[model samples]
Target: MASPPCSAASNFDCGLEIKTRSVEQTLIPLVSQITTLINHKDRLKKTEKTLRAIQKVGQAVGVAVGRFVAVGEAIALENEELREEMGHACFEARRSGTAIAQLTDVCGVEQSAGVDRCTVFSDKMAMVKAARMLLSSVTKVLVLADRIVIKQITSSRSRVLVTLEQLERVSTFQEFVQIFSQFGNEMVEFAHLTGDRQNDLKDEKKRARMAAARAVLEKCTMMLLTASKTCLRHPDCESARINKDGVFQRMRLALEQVIEIVTDARPGAEPKALPISIYNGIQDFKARVEALRDCVYCVPCESLAVQLEALVEQTEDFTDSAYTSHEQRENVLQLCHATRQDTHNLVATFSQDQQSIKAREVSEAMELAILKTSHSVSELRRELHNVAVGRASELLKIHSDHAILQALKTAGEDGNLEKVADLARTLTEQREQLVETCRLLCHISGTEPLEITCIHAEETFHVIGPQIISAAQTFALHPNSKIARENLDVFCESWESQLGDMAVLLKEINDVFEGRRGDKRAYLSLPRPGKHSANLKTVKATKLDAEELSTIAKLGLELRLVTSDVDSELERWEDQNHDLARQCGSMARVVCSMALFTRGEGVLKTTLDLFHQAELLSEQGLQLCSLLQDFSTQLLDEERVLMVSEMEKLAVSCQQLQACAKTPVQGKSATFQKVDSCIQHTKGIMTVVASLLPLWHKLIRQCQSEHSSQASPQHWPDTQLSPPLKEDTLNGKGSNGFGVKSLEQHMASLTFLESK
Candidate 1:
């Protein structure tokens, strides 16, 4: 069910507070129709023109309310818990619509008859009573729909938690595999539901919090698979038990956070003191020492010494870790000691010139000390980043070679237990190396989110090692069992998938260390096809520089506005599978990606990718014209002409967009125009789409007679439009718990099932 609009209709207030973009959008036309009918008093001049206007508006409102009530009744039929309340609301709304329609029925007949007929609507209080009934019942129905959405999310979460418990308690490889498959589907459904909820959220902090919890689940799903396998492989191994248990515990905690966020429950765990990383120390120390330039002797020199010592002390987290290399530990210690000495010297300079604080000699000493300290800390931070990111990069390259996995696969088939044992031992050593590396990286990863990712990595490697061992053992026991071999293969593939995921994590850590946030998914999303796909000996980054990004910020914002308008139109359709609706939705999705691209934060890598998508959007726009022409059969002659003309304009804009996307431009000057023109033309297409969308929607509802109220075009459930999909489609490898197809597909399928 759609959430109620955040703000009720202008001039009409409903007490429920519902805030979602989709719901707000869908209600715009409905509210406009009602507002027109109820506000005839705003213009008291009831001349011939005014009477005609009121009659027309009343007819539109009656038609709209009839269709809305039909949908509400269908929803009531499907959701038993909401049946009685929804049915009452629908009945009242239908009655109010009928009264208003009948009162306005003869207001525009022949002059003398129209005068006599006007008495039916002359009772102002009756019209007012009907308006109130319409507004109140509509609000209640919408609020009830919002409740259903919340309930759907709660049920999905419940399903996931139940499957999670079954997974944790499983023992044998056979049992674990069966339970894990169920766990995976439930996770995918949970992901789909929460992802929708995340996108629908008006609160950015809530969205961000939801995103973090979901990321944990995404990463942990793989870890859970490997950890369970490892526990089965070495049931008696203490480290394996510790590793698997840690993964399950973390996953459970992340799950708890998700449910709490959805239910709006207060967090149960008290917030703990955040760990102080070297990066945090460097920033704090620089801020403190920089302040000394303003007030040298204002604070006690002892305080400066203590603060400097504390900054030096934070480095111990890195230097003292077992995973820190000998060379790295030495470099860190030297830098920390040097930073302490330089800070002490700066403090001493201030102390020595207490009386003549402005003396040049003392000033020079302090300045020199400050410069030395800053340089030392900068070098210290640079070294730490290199050790952490460089080690991860090296490990990834080494692990990319899957020799151990191949040998295990062959040995398991050949029934070579001794060979499998040796391979398992080799895998264990590699796991130890990765686990320690995660610890070292986590020490300097800096941000809490990155740190959480690092811990997840460690848990994954720690657990997957034993899982591989266990899978090998199972294969050795059932050498001829195809299912056992396949199980072993799945575990091995998960290890490789984790390694690939680690490579991504390392890059993210590097981007953060360099202070670049998660803004370049587009570069990674776009394919470097043709010549670009080759391993270049040397080439420039495809990403736009800061200046280019700034130049396009206004255009990007406009892109977001227009595409959102297009999405708003699509949201009103009950048959989201309607040709025009699907076409527009697909275009809106690409526009969304392009808007993010303009901000240097999406999956498109270059202007070329943006052009490619613009071309696709234009093609979809032209196809929408064809669809609209076919759908015009339901509209009146003049209405068809108006809608068709508007669509023709959209098609023309689409042609311009298509031409702009295909045009080749070389230099920076030409390239900039090429991209700007493409996006600008697409915006033009959307503006046309916005104008005609409501008319098309009106035509669809016009077909909703009593005989066909439950037909496809008028039938709406809380579910939006989506393609059908099987549950096992979610079993794709390395998907991070989401299906290979879009999450919307699976989310749609759940509603589809309910409707069926």
Candidate 2:
């Protein structure tokens, strides 16, 4: 009853019509089983997510249909070996681009345009010989299907051998001709499941077929060292003779296949090996034989520096021809022995001053032969006073003939015999011209008149010539009484032997005028003393060591070593004007101290000691002006050594005055006599030309007063000066002075060394 009341509305409906057929059969089967369990749990949650997406699309359709049937049988056997290696890599890329365009048309470069390229290398070698005839049937079906598909590629066929190596790296050539037209239906189902796995080899697969035959013999030994550098950069290559016979016979069969693959990979323990390109081509032929032995040692070092520069120019011309023939045979034997010892002391002092001029020319020829015998005894006493004053007064006519015989006995007894024969024919023609003038005054006073002759002259007969001059004056007063008793015993024995030879030639001319008055007791009886001292002496008395003499007892020590080499070449030509005779003995001691300042009062102390010895000879002529300016600048730098020291002092003063006039004064050598009076006054022959002509004109006037006091810039300004220091002020009056063309070039080189 409670249950019947429980349906309040049911009861009210069942009560309303059995609750409308139990709510229509339990709500239409519970709303069709709750809409068929929500459409069967949304169709089992869309068939368990479409049966886990159709079981992951049947495991990705069995890995994409077993990787699209093993990449459609490895792209149908690599598209039949990539259509036979893409028609042999397009016929080896058109036969290596037509053999590199016929090696750039035989290397003259620029070719490849019209595409001839050896007709594209003969159409790429006929397409690489039809791709090597289909690469031997596609490498025997890819070596039994790539060795059973790379050993059953696990990860679901390694994506079909990685999609057949990405379809052979981008399949082409008409997709390898539609994959080699499906290579007989995928290479007979991949050669029936890759049976016999291509008969294994494996030593790492025979070291990868000997690393592809040592990488094709190291690419044919790098194309035979690039075809010997393309036959050395292609000398107009005929493809360089086909790259030297096909790349040097394919690099000598690729270096004999890299020496048979390094002798079959050197028993491959497998640590590492390779690298043998035929032992690196024998170390590149030993570095090209050491660069041809350094180019043959640089050709003998350039021919030994050109034969050592022609043997140093023939040893400097044979040492200048042996120093110019030993300085011209020692300057021609020192000017022929100091001009033969200064012309033998100027020919023995000019032959001792020509013996007082030959004794005054024999006392003027004996006073002109005693005035010609006193003019023949005054012309025989004026012809005996004209025969005793007028023909002996008519032959002493007995007082004029007794007044003419008492006037002719008073003229009656007749004195008219023809007028006394004309006065006895004028007294016998004046007594025969006075007996021929007394026979010419006894024949000109050679006094031979021992006879007075008046031959029978009838008119002159009584004139017996005065009894023949009284018997020739009684034989001329008897003068020949034995020549007056031998002329008083030879004039008392030749007047004491001519006054002892004129007192020994007046004591040798008073010891040469009292040794020129400096009389050291007139050179102490000088017969020879310190010979005219040009100094140089050496006398260790006595020596004879020509090997202790024996060469004929060392003929005077080989003639005193050959006259000491001719007196050392004659003292080198008497020291060639010995510095111009010591600058003319310091200008004759400044002209004898300016003639001792003109004597007496010692004029200003001998002119300040001769201007202090002429400023010490102008400082020794400016130190001999650097030795006469180094001997006049070595005679202007060797004007043949100052003309061989002035022809060796004029050939040794002419061989010492021709050997002192054929050698004389050896005079028992007491030695001295100023070397025989300087070899008899040869003052070194003209005292070196009178002391070099006034010491070269006072060294060119002291080098023109030192080049007119040297203030260069070609100094000019002359305004005439030089007449004896024209107002002398060189270093004063506004300093810079002395120009005038350097004192007129030192007075024109001191008038050219005073006219040389």
Give the poorly placed runs of model 1, Cα more than 4 Å off: 1-152, 163-189, 199-254, 260-268, 271-274, 307-311, 320-325, 352-362, 515-756
The sequence of per-residue lDDT tens digits that candidate 1 reaches over residues 1-756 is 122222245433355455554555556676676556555564366577867777787888889898889999999999999999999999998998888787666455545653555422365556666766776777778768777887887888788788888878877655554566566567667766776776666554455456556655654554565556555655775545665676678678777777776767766565443456667777777776766666644556557678767766766756776767899899988887887788778777766655584643447676677677778778888887887777778878887778889999899899898998999889998898888778767767777656766676786788667867776776776677543565566567658756765776687778887778845432122222342333323322256654466446445645655564565456556767766677778878888888777656668988778888998898888888887777666567887888778877888898999988877655554566677787778767776665566566656665444225354443222233223322222222122433222222222122100000
Stretches > 4 Å off in candidate 2? 1-583, 586-626, 629-631, 634-644, 647-677, 698-706, 709-756
lDDT of 2 by residue, 1-756 (tens): 011111132222111122122223322322221121112221233333443432332233223323323443544455564455334333332333233223212221124345454321234343233223222222223333343344442222233234333323332222322332232233223222221121122223232233232222222222222233223333343423343344334323422332332233343355243222211222232232222223332233223223323322322222233222454434433433432343233223323433574522324333333343334323323332232223223333333222322332222124233443444354345445444433322221211111111111111223332222221222223323222222222222222222222222223323332344243321022224445444445421222111111111112111212222222122222233455445535544443333223211123242123223333433343343345434454233444365446545644564554444333232223222212232222323333333244234333344445556664222112122224321121111112332121221121111000000
Cα-based RMSD of candidate 1? 20.3
Best by lDDT: 1
Provide the global lDDT of candidate 1 against the true structure: 0.66
lDDT of every model, 2 decimals: 0.66, 0.29
Q: CA lDDT of 741 in candidate 2? A: 19
